[model samples]
Target chain A: MIQSFKMALKSIAGNKLRSFLTMLGIIIGVMALVILVSLVSGATGSVTDSIFSLGSNLLTVTISDDKGAPINLQTLNEWMEKDGIGLIAPSGETSATARYEGNSGSVTVYGTTPPYETINGLSLLLGRFIKSSDVDNHTNVAVINETAATELIGYTDCIGEEVSLDGVKFTVVGLLEDDEKSLTAVFGRGSVVAYIPYTSLMRLSSEATSNITSFSVSAETDMATAEAAVTSLLMERFDQDDDAFTVSSRDMLEDAMSDVTSVLMILLGSIAGISLIVGGIGIMNIMLVTVTERTREIGIRKAIGAGRGVILQQFLLESVVLCMFGCAIGVFLSWAVLRIISVVVSSLSISFSLEWNVVLIAVGFCFLIGIVFGLYPANKAAKMEPVEALRYGG
Target chain B: MIDLKNVSRVYQVGSGKVYALNKATLHIDAGEFVSIVGPSGSGKSTLMNIIGCLDIADSGTYLLDGIPIEDYTETELAKIRNRKIGFVFQSFNLIDKLTAEENVELPLIYRGVGKAERKARVAEVLERVGLTKWSHHLPTELSGGQQQRVAIARAIVTKPSLILGDEPTGNLDSKTTGEIMEIFRELHEQGNTIMLITHDQEIAEQASRIIHIRDGVLSEVSI
Candidate 1:
């Protein structure tokens, strides 16, 4: 076996250009496999991380049809006092043009009560979130994230600064810390955003209503019980019509996201796998050519007492070694490509690293391809009659 | 020792049957240097192929050192060729990629010899063939005579019972041919059995006993 391996290496080394050309298909195949799979996994990982960062025990409620029985801040507060409910924050959103010292931009204004901060896991960089008194007094105070602070107010420490929303003045009480890795940061492109008291938003924008159509709730205990409780409450409020509202927990959303991404990963991986099969065919083609070219060598070896098994072993080893070489180069190139991608997307904070499982799959797949593709040509060479082979080109 | 009785090899040519080797019988004792001479299409190669265990006869009972050659499987025949026969071809047939020493070690490698023993045997044969200094050179780097010497060393490295030379000096110049023939004479003196097949009268004349083949029939000629 060792002798066969040595001979295989010698033969491969003897024809450097042809060997490298033959391996190119395998190299490209492996690169595609590793890079595509790793990118999907890396993106999925960051997305999942951001999802979990939103708070795993949180449930979101959206009312498509209130059915003449709408939820309000008072009702949400009452629900917060019930079992399985930790905090309830009723929210509504309206886009408005905001101005600060004549510099104006369109900003999305989220109307929510004090419990919104805890439920959404929002962290403050300065001042404080909306207070319970602020909601009751209908105080025109706003909280802005880092993007809003930088884009509209020029800095993050803009607390106590008043900004006009559609010509109505509101004091900035808090500056929310920016999460570049958040799904919003990835998809929303850091747009100007603000959070104000729900009552204040109702007074400022005609589009804002007293009815709370959307709200988020953090579970005090298990999420399933909290979800069931909220569902029952919504069902009772809507005359037992479940279609009036929808209650979905963070865990369910996370599972759905992963399922979609995993399916995407498999689809991408198989596409790359097709390229690997093409690469294997390329190997088989070259190996067949090599066998024909070295027919005399086979005859010589056979005449000197080499059996069919030895000849088969030598040719098979040659192809396998060629594929493995291609795989090694492909893996290295994938790493470099991923490094480049990571550098390019560093602002999004999505680091694309080579996943070990994907690498293992690439390697294992390449080995299988080697054996599967190499067998035919090797068998052909092995089965040649010594005299007929010798007589070839004599 | 070798034995053959009524050995014949047939070939299908279109719709006609052609006899590559006719029903013929021959014998030679151990340590004999014998030669078979014939023209291009007179079955000299067929005779050599059968004797070298490369091709099976259609009808024959041939024995090599008391073992029946016809009863053996393909793998067993390969073993017989590896253990009992050494073939020197007209074109030298050294693998182009391997070094001279590596080429000489081929038979020993197939025989499953240990690396150390193979190396020692290879070196000994290279020294015997007077090509020790060229052992590290590839066949492409060596001269025609040197490559033929490497092939000869490879053949003798396993101490095979029969050294079958099928026009071994056919590609060499006259001087190199004379040198190769001298080596064969020395090997025969050392009690090694040798068989030389050639169409050249001068080359066959050098062997101790010569056999003539015309139209696939063989007749012994005492030299």
Candidate 2:
């Protein structure tokens, strides 16, 4: 077997250009498989990380129909005191134009109470989040993100500065720190955003209502129990109509995202696999030519006492070695390609790296292809009659 | 020792049967230097192939070293060829990509010889053939005589029982042919069984006994 491998290497080395051209198909196929799958997995990983960074223990509740029992600030406070529920914050949002001195910019205004900071994992760089007193007194105060502060107020330290929303004045009491690794940072790069007390938002924007339609709840312990408690509460509030409200946890979103990405990965993988099959066909084609070209050599070996099995093994090993070499090169190139991609998307903080399993799959697939495609030609060479083969091309 | 009884090989030439070998019977004792001289298409190669275990006769029994050749499987025939017969072809059929030493080591490899012993045997045979300095050169790099010498070395490397030469010097010049024939004469003197197939009357006269074939019939000619 080792001798056959040596012979295979010699034959492959004997025809450098033809061998490389044959392996090029396999190389491209493996590159496509490894790079595409790794990119999807890397992107999915970063997205999941960012989603968890937003707080996996948090549940988002949206009420399509409040029915008769509309949730208010008092009701949210009461729900927070319930079992498995750590904190509950009523949230509503509206797009409004904000002006400070001569600077004006459009911003998304999220209306929520103090616990919204912890529930959503938002941190303030200056001042404080909305206190319960602000929500109760309907205070005209707003907390703006770093983008809003820098864009509208021209600086982050502009705390206590007055910014007008649709001609209504509100004091900017806090500035949010910028988190470039967050999902919002990636999807909402240049957008200005602000947070105000839910009561104040209801008063300032015509689209914002006193009835809470959306809210976020953070679990004190197990998320499943907390989700169950919230669902039952909504079910009771909406007269046992489960469809009146939908309570979604971060786990659901994470699962759905992974499912989508996995499908995408398979789609990409099989498409690349097709190219690999094409490459295998290329190997078969060249191997056939090689067998025909070296018919006399086959005859010489046979006449010198080589058996059919030995001849078959020699040709088969040659093809498999060719494929494996291509696979190795493909994997290395994929890693380099991923590195280039990582550098390109460094600002987004998503690093693309080669996954080991994908590399293994590529290698295994290449080996299989080698055996599958190399068999016919190897068998052809093996089954040739020694006398006839010896007489060939004389 | 080799034995054949009523051996016949038939070929279908467009719905017509042509006998390549026609009920010919022959025997060669151990250590005998024998030659079969025939014209082209006179079944010289067919007889050589059957004797080499490269082909099976359609009808008849061939025995080499007392084992029936027709009863053996393809793999067994290959083993017989590897251990009992060494073939030297007219074209000096050395694989172009392999070095001379490697080509000489082919039969030993098929015989499952250990690497060290194969190397030793190959070196010894290369020295015997007066091509030790050319052992590492490829067939394309060697002269016709050197290439033929390498083929002879390859044939003898396994120390096989019989050396079958099918027109071994057919492509060499008269001087090279004499050189190759001298090597055969030396091997025969060393008690090796040698069978040389040739069309040259002068080369056949060099053998201890000659068998002439015409139209697939063999007749012994005392020289």
Candidate 3:
């Protein structure tokens, strides 16, 4: 076996470029596999992460339209304080540019009640969050996230500082940690956030503030009953008009995102897998050519005392080495490419983690490709008659 | 020792049976140098191949060292080839990818010789072939004569009991031919049994006994 392995190495070393070209297919195949696994796993990781960060059991209520009699805040609050509801933090949002000295960036100005941070798993990194008295007084006070602190103020711990937004000065009482899958970015230029009293934001609202974007509600018991209660409460309040308002659960969001990811994985996996099969065929084609090219050599070996088994072993091992070589190259390329992309585009929230199991599967597939494609050519060389093979020109 | 009785081989050329060998009987004692000389397609190669355990006769009895060839399985025949016979071909079929030392190690590797012993034996054989200095060169890097000597080193590295040379000097110049024949003469003097097949009469004359094959018939000619 060792002898055959040595021979395989020598044979490959004889034509290094040709060997690499032949392995191009395997490289592409393994690369596709790695990329596909990374994309799916990375997307899934962020989705599940966001869902978990929504705290233990949470429901989001959205009044999509508020043209007629608007949603009564007191009625909604009283209903949420009833059976399955543990807490409610109604919120509204508007896009505004925040300025502190010369550092001005677009930010999402959020209007919310107190329990927002506790229900939504948000933490104060430096100072206090918005309080109920601030909401009742309609104070021009703000609790800014890390993005606002860094992008506008250029540093952390900007507690008790004041930043002007939409030409109104608001005190930054708290510095909340940045929400890692930033939903605020979906509304504005991203990287800056501020939360003040809902009444203060509503009083300054233009046309966009008529409807609430969403308000988070924690379940007193579990998520299922909270979602059901929220759905039914909205259904009764809107005269059983299900389309008037929407209620979504963290579990539902997770399931939807997971389903999308599954479909994405299958589609990407097959496209990549097809390329791998193409690469395996490429290996087979080259191996067959190699056997033909080495027919005379095979004859010589056989004449000089090589058995059929020995010839088969030598040829098979040569192909196996070729595939594994390509695998190593492909693996390195994929890892490097993924690392660069994640680092260069840090805000993408799409991480490219190394999936060892996927890599192992790809490696194993390389061996399978080696054996399946190599057997025919190796056997062909092994079965040749010495006299006939000796006469072969190549 | 080698024995043959009424050995024959038939090839299907298109739709006709061409008998490359026909019931040609011959014998050679242990430690004798014998040559079979014939014109091209006169069954010289057929006879050598059969004797070298490289081909099976359709109908005949062949015995190598007292074991009937027909009784052994294909794998057994391979073992017999690996263990007992050394072959030198007309083309000097040294694998182009292998260095001279690696080429010479082929048969010994097949015989499962240990690394240390294979190294020692390969050095000794390369020295015997008078090409010890070129032992590390690839076949393509060596001259024709040097390549043939490497092939010879490879053939004898296992110290195979029977050495069969099929037109071993067919591809060489007259000078190189004489040099290779001198190596054969030295091996013969060392009491190694050697069988050579060639179409050249002068090459045949160098052997102690010459046998002629014409139209698939074998006749002994005193040398």
The residue-by-residue lDDT of candidate 3 on B1-223, one tens digit each, is 7899999999999999999999989889988999899999899888888898888999999999998988876556778888888888888888887899999998888888899999999999999998889888889999888888888888788777899998999999999999999999999999899999999989999899999999788999884
Per-residue alpha-carbon lDDT of candidate 1 for residues A71-104, written as tens digits (9 for 90 to 100): 8888988898999888899888899999999699
- lDDT of each structure? 0.91, 0.91, 0.84
lDDT measured at residue A106 in model 1 versus the true structure, 0 to 100: 89
- lDDT (C-alpha) at residue B94 in model 2: 95
What are the per-model DockQ values?
0.85, 0.77, 0.58
Among these predicted structures, which one has the highest TM-score?
1
In model 1, residue pairs whose N, Cα or C atoms come closer than 3 Å (at least 3 residues apart or on different chains), thus clashing, are none
Q: What DockQ number belongs to candidate 1?
A: 0.85
Q: What is the lDDT of residue A161 in candidate 1?
A: 97
How is the predicted docking of candidate 3 categorized under the CAPRI scheme?
medium
Task: Place model 2 in a CAPRI quality band.
Answer: medium
Residue by residue across A1-394, what tens digits does model 2's lDDT show?
9989999889989999998999999999999999999988888888888877778789999999988788888889899999989899988999898998999878889899999999988888899899989988999999988888888888789988999998899998998887665776765464578899999999988777878899999998989989999998888889999889888888898888988998999999999999999999999999999999999999899888899999999999988998998888889999999999989888777778999999999999999999999999999999999888988998
> Once model 1 is optimally superposed onto the true structure by TM-score, how far is the C-alpha of residue B188 displaced, in angstroms?
0.4
* Fnat of every candidate, listed in order: 0.77, 0.68, 0.66
- Best-to-worst order by lDDT is 2, 1, 3
Clashing pairs in 2: none
Cα lDDT tens digits for candidate 2, B14-95: 9899999999899999999999999999999999999999999999999999999999887778888988998999999999
lDDT, residue A319, candidate 3: 90
